[model samples]
Each structure stands twice: as C-alpha cells, then as structure tokens.
Target: MPSLLEVLKFLGAGVLGLTLGVEGLSWLYRRLKPAGSSRISEVLFFPCESHCMESLFSDGRVSGDQCVCGETHSTALQSSPVDPFYRMLSHLLSARVSLDICVFSFSNFELSRAVLQLHARGVRVRVITDRDYQTIQGSQIGVLRKAGICVRHELSRSVHMHHKFCIVDGRLLLSGSLNWTMTAVQSNQENVLVTDHADIVAPYLAQFRRLWEANDPARHTHSPGNADTYAPRHHGHVHKGHYADRVKGLVHRAEVEKHTASNGHVYQQ
Candidate 1:
C-alpha cells in the first residue's frame, strides 16, 4: 500500500483536478450560449406525495398512452405531464438571465446536480440560506461557486430565512414551506406552489434581493434583534420549544375542524 501522506496527496490532487475540470467546462459552455435568449414559460407542480415521483425515479418506462380500446398509442412529448421536481430542474437549466434560490438547508444530490447543471449551462444562479446552516451545505456551495454560481446567506440574525423559495429569470416564483432537504420531500408534511403571476413573483424577488443585498458580516458579531419578534405568535407547544407558531396554528386549526365535525352540519376544514 502507498504511504499515508502519498495517499492523502493523491486524493487531494484528484479533488483539485475534478474541480478545475468542472469549472473549465462551465466556462466553455458560457462562452457558447448567448445570454438572454431563453424565455419564461408556464409553471407546473406535483404534490410532495404525488405518485408521479415514483414513476419519475423508476427504471421502468410507461411505454405509451392507453387508447379507448386499451391499445397503447404513441403520445406526444409536449402533452406529457412533467414531474414537479423535473420541471424545477428544467427551469434552472433553461434560465438565461438568472436563477435565484433561497432555502433553509439543501443536501439532496439531485438538487445539487440541477444547480451545477444550470451553472454549467451559463445561467447566472444565486443561492441564499441561513448562516448557521451554511456549513451543512458548504460542499454544495463550493461546487456552485466553482461553476460560476453566486451563493450567499441571509443576514437577519433571528429569522434564519425560514422561507423556501426560488425565482427563475425574475419571472417565475416558487414558494412554500418545502425546504431543499430530503425529509421535506420524502417524509415531512410540506407544501410548495409555483406561480407565473407577476404579482406573486415580484414581491418574492424583492424579498430575495433585500436579503441578497445585505453585506456578509463576520461570524459571532451580528446580533439577532426584534427580527424574530415579528414572527406569528401562538399558544401551542412544540418538541423543540414553543417555537414554530405556524405549526401550532395548524394544530389549532385541526382542533377547530374536529369540533365543527362533531356538529350536524358538514363543513370544509
């Protein structure tokens, strides 16, 4: 076996070489693609628990569409519905002007790949997350920056940018409580909605811009002030603490629904 130092040196060299190669490829791709050529199109979504996810990640093909007589027929690609995550990846890859993302934590391999793919395609991608959670995603950000994506963190000390959102080309907005974490998709109850409406996208763009524009401060220096004070207040308790008033509110709503159901009148919760 090689000496310990030699093995370490070899591994270091391999990592350095891979990083350089990815950066070089990204540079070449940017040189070839003209800027501002891609346009914003329609947006789509799939509920986090949608069965479509299994089909998307499955190795087996759907074959074709079933006709009225039960015969499988060739289906047009354009009409085929898209998986939500794939649609998100497609938007990132097709971005010409910019791709902006804000999340709490991102460790999913597929998401990282999409970000790298878009960066390699020459689209400007910017990511912002909580400072405390940055180290959890440091490797991903390093890969992103090396591929020419600008990455940063939220400056608000108390809030931690609990928001999960993305803006594609400044025209498309994705928002909700769904963070880029695996649990959020595969287990935790979460929600996300994509909207092409300017009214929705504009405000989120502004919010992201506000957070992005803040200067990066030195660690252990900044103070988290009344920033969290604005958070919604609640009376219910949580496992970590009485925090997450949002979830508390959801629980309260559930109780109210149960109370109403006990009555004779049928009502929607």
Candidate 2:
C-alpha cells in the first residue's frame, strides 16, 4: 500500500491540476470574446439631469438624440443620445452573440423583456443572482428561465449575491448601483458605469466564470445541468408579446417607495 506521505503528494497534484484547469477555462473564455474598440465608455447617473428630458437631435449642433451632460462631459450639448435610460436599453439590445447578467434582483419588465429578446435571437444568455431574491415576487428570473435561458443563483443562503452588472457580447461591461428592478430604474437614485476596456472587462469575466461554476447545478447535485433552450419556431414567427414603448416606458415618479440605498441609508424615491 502507498505510504501516507505518498498519498498526500498524490492529492496535492490533483488539487494543482484542478487550479490549472480552472485558469485554462478563463483563458479560453477571454480568447472567445470578440475584441473591439471601446466606443461606449461613460458613467451614467440615475435621475438623469433635466437636460436628458429635452428634445433630441432638434439642436443643429447634434446629429442623433443622446443624453449629453454638456456641463460635465464638455459642452452644454453635442452628438450623443439625448436620454440616459434609452442609451442603456440600446446597449442591451445591441448584444448579438452573448449577454451575461450578474445582479441581485431582476424585476423590471422592460429589462427582462430585453433579455428575453436577446435569448430569442440565439444570443447565449446567462444570469447569476442571489438565491433569495431570485424567487422574490416581481422577479423576472422565472420569466427568463421559462424562456429557456440559463439562470444560476448563489449556493449559500446566509450571504447574498448582490452584484449588479452585465456584460454584452463579452465586450461592453455595464456595472453600477442599479438593480434590474422597476424601483431602481424609475425611482431610486442609481448609477451604471458602461465601458469596453479589456483590462476592466477581463476581471469581471473571470469572476462571473467562477460564480457560474461554483453555483453550477452539477456541483450542487452532482448531475449535469439540463438547462432548457428555446425551441425552434416557424420562419418569420415572432413572440407576439407587447411591452411599453422604449426608454421612457414609464414616467419617473417623483414619489417612490421606501428602500435602502447602497450606503445603508434609508431613503425614498
């Protein structure tokens, strides 16, 4: 029989191999991400400035309607989307290959619909959320899963998966204080930082890969994940679901429900 020291060395080698395998997976994931220039890089503040509510492109100086914080960005206004929320939605819709979402809660109908649309289009979509909030009323996790999207949740119940960020086509990284909930979008003061920088996006990609594997159903159940996929439909067939119109889907209610901000301060919308 092998001595204790020999067995110990054998176990150590196995552990080292596991580490290398995980690292190899991360490297492959990065290689698969289509590289591109960082065209969209900006931090967006919630409760957008009043200027965002103004008319779009009507100004002779600008081309398309995009919210431009002239005072902060440079001029009073120039060429940019005139609305912040619309910009967010547009980026979400821009995903063509893959979209990954890591957030605490997802209840906002518009955002959920956007995710569904992406899934319908063959874009591989994955969601990682806290276990508790995934089933919380108004959550769209169920909706997403029902549509054949892969959704994972935290393994522990004592702690929370409170991350609020998403990656589009493995390029654009959207990280911020905003949750994918109605209150976060239309009421609470939140912020979302959008960027496509490789250095920044790489770390998040690794973290997501870690969480996804850690929370894998196979890991927990020792069985392969049988994630559902959207069934093929007839040509030109579309899911006849209707959602509220674009960015300004709902009026930003001045009066909002009570909630706790990230700073631990209790406040109202």
Candidate 3:
C-alpha cells in the first residue's frame, strides 16, 4: 500500500518525533527538580565511609565520597599580631561573668579601662601581680584598687610573680609570655594563647586559686604613712588604729580619679 520512499519518510518522521519527545521530557524533569538534589542523591547513594570523611561531608553534599557542604569542614585557626593589645581588649570586653588576671606587670591604661568597664557591668574581676612592679610611676594598681576591684600582690618578695595569664568567664584561658602592659603589648614581642580547652584551663584555674588564697590582702597589715608599705602580721603583735587615719590621709592627698581618653582608656592623673 505504501511506496518504499514514502515508507522510509514516514519512519524517519516517527523517529524524529520520538527523539524530540524524549528531549522535551528531559528538559521538564531538569526544570522541576529541586536544586542540589543531585548532590544529596550522590551522598545518600555513596555515604562517606571514613569517620573524618563523614564529618567532613555530613551535610548531604558529596564529591567523590567526600562531603563538600559542611561549613565546619575546613579547620580554622586564629592568630594575633605581635601587638595583641586589641585582641586582649576584645576578650576582656566579651566577659559576661568573671575575669581573673595574673601578670608580672600591669600598666596599660586601656587595659585598666576595660577592667573597670567589666566591673561596672557587674562582672567580677580580680587581679594579682608582682608587689614591687605595682609601685612603678605609671602602674595602674592604685587606680584599680581605688575603683574597688580586688587587687593583690604576691607575698613573697624573693620570687617574682611572673605569671601572665587571664581567665574569662571560667571558659576561656589566655596565657603566654604577654604581660598586661603598654610596652609589652605595643612594643615587646609576645604571644597569647586563647583557648577553651578543659585540659589546659583546669590546671591554670587551680593555680590561680592557690595564689589568690595565699596573697589575700586581709592577711597583711598596711602602714598608715604609706599605703604601699605592707607588713606581715606577727601572731603576738597588734596593729595600732592610726593605720586607718594614715590610709585616709593618703587617699585625701593623692586624690586618685578616673581620667578617660578619647580612645576609651582610663588613666590616673
């Protein structure tokens, strides 16, 4: 009934129609499918085998059995410049509950301001440092003490209170060779390790507590003539009441007050 040429032409038309229909269906499927479905399907099908690989790719996006979708897959390390004063300031500012600091020296005005600000915010703060160091001309111990922040000096004069560390909110520990001073922060080469690791924090916490208890200010007596002069109590000796009068005289004469700079640092003038 049909000629050979006509039959060939009809078969060719049918084949073309079938190919076009298949192409149209493929385009519609691609359009209707959700984005990232292929990645999810690949992950589901392969499933990362190794623990590290699984952790790296656990977000359901895979590349050759590796996860590429996890945000935390890549390790991140933070570092500070040679001058870590700003970093220290940031850490101090972020404290919500308490701050414990021990250093060989602390004379930075900016650091003093940060401590005062933290105290103002109802965050408990404590400090321990070398006794002789605080007697320096620009030392901030007097300012800190005047502000009602608990400041203590090491009892032993022979051994230097050379530790430089800070604990923030009992969670983060900052320690290393850095001293809380403008010279150490701005000029000297120093490093501070800030970590929340429990292994490292626990020991430092214990050490701080020990030092804090051993150097309690109440255990010693201050001379009335000079507030900086501290003498250990003899079991049999009683201190005269004139010591209070001397302290009042010194406070009245010194007239310590908080002087703020444009940069928010508190200085004693």
Best by lDDT: 2
Per-residue lDDT over 1-269 for candidate 1, one digit per residue giving the tens place of the 0 to 100 score: 89999999999999999999999998887567554433443434333432332222222245443223243222332256454555555555556778899887776556787677667767788898764455442236556666767777654434556678888888877787666755556566565676666555789999888777663443213226632222312343222332464355446546655665677432211
Candidate 3 stretches with Cα past 4 Å from truth are: 1-83, 221-225, 233-269
User: Runs in model 2 with CA error above 4 Å?
Assistant: 1-37, 48-80, 222-269
lDDT of 3 by residue, 135-212 (tens): 655788889989999988886544679998989998778888777676565456567777765556789999999999
The lDDT values for all models are 0.59, 0.70, 0.66
lDDT of 2 by residue, 13-96 (tens): 999999999999989876775655456788877765433322222223442334354534312343456456666877888899
Worst 10 residues of 3 by lDDT: 40-49
Worst 10 residues of 1 by lDDT: 50-59
RMSD of each: 16.3, 15.7, 25.5
Q: Considering lDDT, which of the candidate structures 2 and 3 is the better prediction for this target?
A: 2
Ranking by TM-score: 2, 3, 1
Better of 1 and 3 by TM-score: 3
Clashing pairs in 2: 65-81, 65-82, 66-80, 66-81, 66-82, 67-81, 67-82, 67-83, 70-75
